[model samples]
Target: MNQNNKVKHPKGLTFLFLSEMWERFGYYLMIGIFTLYLKDVKAGFAMTEAEAADLYGTFIALVFLTPFLGGLIADRYFGYTKSIIIGGLMMGVGYCMMAIHSLPILYLSMTLVIIGNGFFKPNISTLLGNIYSTPEYEDKKDEGYNIFYMGINVGAFICNFFGAALYILLGWGYAFLAAGIGMFLGVGIFLYGMKHYRAFDVKKGMQQGDMSFLKIVMVILFPAVIAGVIGWVVPTQVLGHALIGSPSTDAFIFACIPVIYFYGSLLAKADKSEKRPIAALLTIFAVVILFWAVFKQNGSALNTWADRYTDRHVENPMAAKIFSGLSLSQQLTMAKDSVPLYDEAFRLQKADGKVLQEYNYPTYFKNVAPEKRLAEGTQIEVWATNISQSINPGWVILLTPLIVAFFTWLRKRNQEPTTATKIAFGLLISALSVLVMIGAVYSGGNGAEKVSVFWLMASYGVITIGELFLSPMGLSLVSKLSPVRITSLMMGGWFLATSIGNKLSGVLATLWDTYENKANFFWINFFLLLFSALVAFMLLKWLNGIMREKGIK
Candidate 1:
């Protein structure tokens, strides 16, 4: 390879970027609408806020958890490329199956996605790290991951438009089908670029002292399944109540015990040479759980915020026209007889098993000022609430280059922050984002009024910067520090922490309705992140010392 080409990103980065992009396109599109689909009064399952958030949380938690087995299998049996292909196809089928309305089918579809993502997510990341392992690309590894992160956002940002259009033009099922198509497209792209990464798909089969595959199946997988079943059945059946918030939550937490122990055992049993780096990675993993706990709210609690609390009206006619043309906006009329009525609390009123109230307007108009309210027959165009899910990805697309350039400039001056330091700052910056939401809550008068959409945008912008700093850097850090034989397994550990946090996000979201003073809810989030950032700062010296010992900057 030419020196210039070596210093720049490898050609394989392009294919990986595109492949990950379309994969996220499908995944995020499905996620963006998941709770909404579950709660839709007509076409959906009519789940309550707590019920929807609980299921959403458990679903995503399991989605991240399966990567543990997936990574281990790829490391010991299959190569990265083959695992990625299999995972992609499985997810594609899962997304398409979600189009079916039956609950049993929906559960089956979710199972496919959860299992597929396990195989897909960690290996691709490990492969990217491998490609940068060469001497020339080594120095630019952080930059490579940052650029790859941009590709993820590019797909995430655009998928909502297609989802909104498909759902609005046809129905929810069509929108889901599009997610499957995007996933298949991603798998095809990965296959097309296989030649570029084929050499890097090196699998490190079972090493000395490593448990045999059958032993792992007996020891880890079977125990986890059994424990999970106990967690699910014991609470609701024997105890006659949930020990946790729900059975699924209990089951997930219980299932994780065995997996978490497995990772811990790795640290305990590792050779002395690998100890400190593994310790550092595990420490960082533990701390970043708080970050994901708060950040993953973009799908659940934040989605609810956008749907019911944010004013999404398009005041500009040209923008409205464009949005309408794209099927990204819906027009609502203040017609007396057409809209359903809910109480001041936004709950439906029923008497004798029949809806008793006949309010003449949609629930969205409840918080409008009397003066601002339109005439009875007037129509207003508002963007789809789910479309707000795109804001974080939109900010990522816009700010990634600037963030990359700023870091590059710092690198040239020999003043670039260590990856660990960037992550510490990422936590602190993300904490500030919660304060923004608190401000929104205050501005909205504790949900008594609708707030401007700008608040959501601003919060997402602040957090996107934090995400760019932390998420990709974490991936690079894992790649750099992990032992060659166990790289993918450690990658699985990273996702495990993410899995815990995602579940906690759902747990937090279930409390959304219980808080009368909503700012208090956000305040709790702020404190969690702030504590994590403080802890990260406290450990900086020790973490940096480990990095220096490894001869990495």
Candidate 2:
């Protein structure tokens, strides 16, 4: 029985896995269709590509930002279990509220989700860490987290199918409502397994030399709010135009200033023993910002690629029939409509205040060869674009076990790379992933024709490997290196980097319409990632030395 127990994971892990899976199901389901919903002319807001991408960027940035405060609050006031419950409930309601058509209600719902994520995201992970701190599970903590991460991707992978079916069969509202139901289901699972992790729900209120709750509110939160408001209002009101991609973008960047300062101050005030570790973590955080900036594009720019450029038409009659019966695909007619003519660079052409081409065709057929063009009334069954959002997580689900085995094999031979080494290599490999898109652009004749969905699949496959190497390792590095009292603060720094990177992704995506040569746009991403990898390689020795000082791999 003891030997069997050693081979098996704890019961709590199962519950945590189910809970996180459901929570992600709700979150990713909403994200999968968000921009598409925003751009729908009749049912959605009819936002332009830039407008939708900007909003999507801001929303996701805030979603990551709140976890800083949420984790802090859970540690100081609410315990992990309670905070997770509250956050989950808030998010559940927020998803349901998204079903409402009112703009005001949508904003309100978004705020709830941002705040809820702050509470739920960090606390649950922390609780898991606490559970694994026990002697029996300590050796297997990394395995546990890898398992937990897979649960997140599992939810992410399947939610798109449900979302596509629900939206196709009913409407966007029903799909959003399904997200809310998923969140509630997650909360229920967490509650049912409460006893398993209840012992680890301990909270440490105020500690010696720690700032009081009121002080934190006054110095950090209040200042951030004021700065954000000023950023939102001042740029357009004073300058007559946005200083950034959008007002929300400006606001988020400005709000981050105070928080950035706070983290900086920690480095200044940290003890000699703590100083080097904090600085090392901060340097890493800054470098990985480039990674998130590129990866987060899945929801915006990539979604657009899948929607407008990919060959999603289901050619197999049986497959098309299955998709149609399941409401997983939409049947679109190639009806003629007004579309603008393009110049040599593919920019829209105009003459005397009128579009050059009066014969408008559906956008999906814009790049098809004239000889291959279908009749005006011909109908095609095409898979929903949102389904493409699942590709990364699907890759995650498929590759994780293999990745774990590969790393485990290395560990046994004493040949596993250091965390820093893995991250540096991850960045380099991610840079290579951009070449796939460059290939895709060439294959599609710079958007003059549709390319096979296989290109997107291959790109996602490469990047998922990069993500597996860097993302989990970063989290573990923080736990291994941070001073006990300041660990939470360092964690906040990681999220800050992620939030900033997410916003940058949006900013880059806004330029999608401007780039006549789409390859140029992907090239920019490649360079950014390559630069980050170079920086990581230069710092690798020093970072590894710090790990040695801390006596961790």
Candidate 3:
């Protein structure tokens, strides 16, 4: 092997990077406003917090879940480029359709996104790995992935501002339409670089003894649909208060049963040489589910905290003016007007007499002292709640270079941690980030007052370090550990873990009002991550031994 000071990676990386960035721009833009859209009394479904969180969780989970089937189709029949193109178009149309404002149309739009993501997500990732498979690029694989991951965060970081501006200026429909436009741009970029990735777009086709596509539909798809219907229709009384909180929850879990079994069958059928690596990957996947269950709350639980509990008012006149000009600041008028009185769970508080509607009921000054209240009819400028979603990606952009450098330094000294060790440590670090939220809960007097925005920023900063450690490593791990024949399939398996944990995050968030002491909620998240970390730590030596056996570091 020749070592070169200046390694030239495939030119295709640039195209993939841009395409994925735009795709994520569209996706994150929509997600940044999803719950907000669902909960808006004037323009949205007017759902309660729990209702919105449940639906958000289910939607995102399905978005990730489809990639499993998408990867299979891409690997066997469609090839990466075709699958990606089709998926992008579907998603673009879906985002545009979300502007329709009908409940049935909303569901239809979500379904398109879910299906499109299945075709788009895993295939693009697998295509990148294929480009890096040659001996010349093998050593740079991790670095390539890190660069690619940064592109994702870049898109995620900038999208919220655009979303906020569009929502404020033109309304929700225009904001969603912007998401569609972003997807179309991404598709266009992908097509421009078609020539570069064409060689790597070779389909795996069917292997000897492999299940046929038709068989998969019959055995996996049909069973999953039937199971979902059964779960949805079964009476709660018969099952003892809904197996997992709602009909969709039960249905999704039931549908996943066959999928989980399918992965198990993969392990059962693998050759002896492949068993240990597959088992190791599966074990890691299971442990990481808890990590995502906690981490993914950035969208739901944390978003709620940012909206209702954090002090978002811009005290500085210049900053306020600038943000307001950009349509990134929300103005609340201090005048008597009709407003819904919401309970702890954000449900409309019902009353018999008059149904009193206080102006700006969940007012910014609700927890402020009398001296702090603005004069009547005054319009106070506050930061938009959804802008808080940018913090994590902002942290990612700032920290990725440093993390890469630190790991590179360790590699130079021959002291770099194994991927499993890195992941275990990531979980532990993320667990500690929850402690910051715990502090915020206490400092805010258990949600009786608004806390400083720095607390949220600090927590995101801490968790981002953990994210840089785990997320990219998981992608690289799958590339390194999976058998060549089933690489994309295993990537789908990784995403399945993510999908399950994402749904669990929503479930946990739905229980937000159940805890009177808000600190207990953060505590629950902390313990869950801590438990996962401990399990990962306990298995570290064993996992590392397997990695050594398979010649992966």
The sequence of per-residue lDDT tens digits that candidate 2 reaches over residues 415-476 is 99999999999999899898999999999999888999999999999999999899988988
Against the true structure, candidate 2 reaches a TM-score of 0.93
Where's the lowest-lDDT run of ten residues in candidate 3? Answer: 338-347
- lDDT tens per residue, model 1, 421-511: 9999999999999999999999989887889999999999999899988997998899888887677668777888998999999999989
Q: Residue 310 deviation, candidate 2, in Å? A: 0.4
- What's the best-to-worst order under lDDT? 2, 1, 3
lDDT of each: 0.87, 0.88, 0.85
What are the root-mean-square deviations of the candidates from the true structure over C-alphas? 3.4, 3.4, 3.3
**Position 157, candidate 1: lDDT:** 92
Top lDDT prediction, candidate number: 2
* Model 1 TM-score on a 0 to 1 scale: 0.90
TM-score of model 3 (CA atoms): 0.91
**What would the per-residue lDDT of candidate 3 be over residues 366-479, giving only the tens digit for each residue?**
564335555545566777777899999999999988998999999999999999999999999999999999999999889778899999999999999999889878977998
Pairs of residues at least 3 apart in sequence or in different chains that clash in candidate 2: 337-360, 338-360, 339-360
Which ten contiguous residues of candidate 2 have the minimum total lDDT?
Answer: 338-347
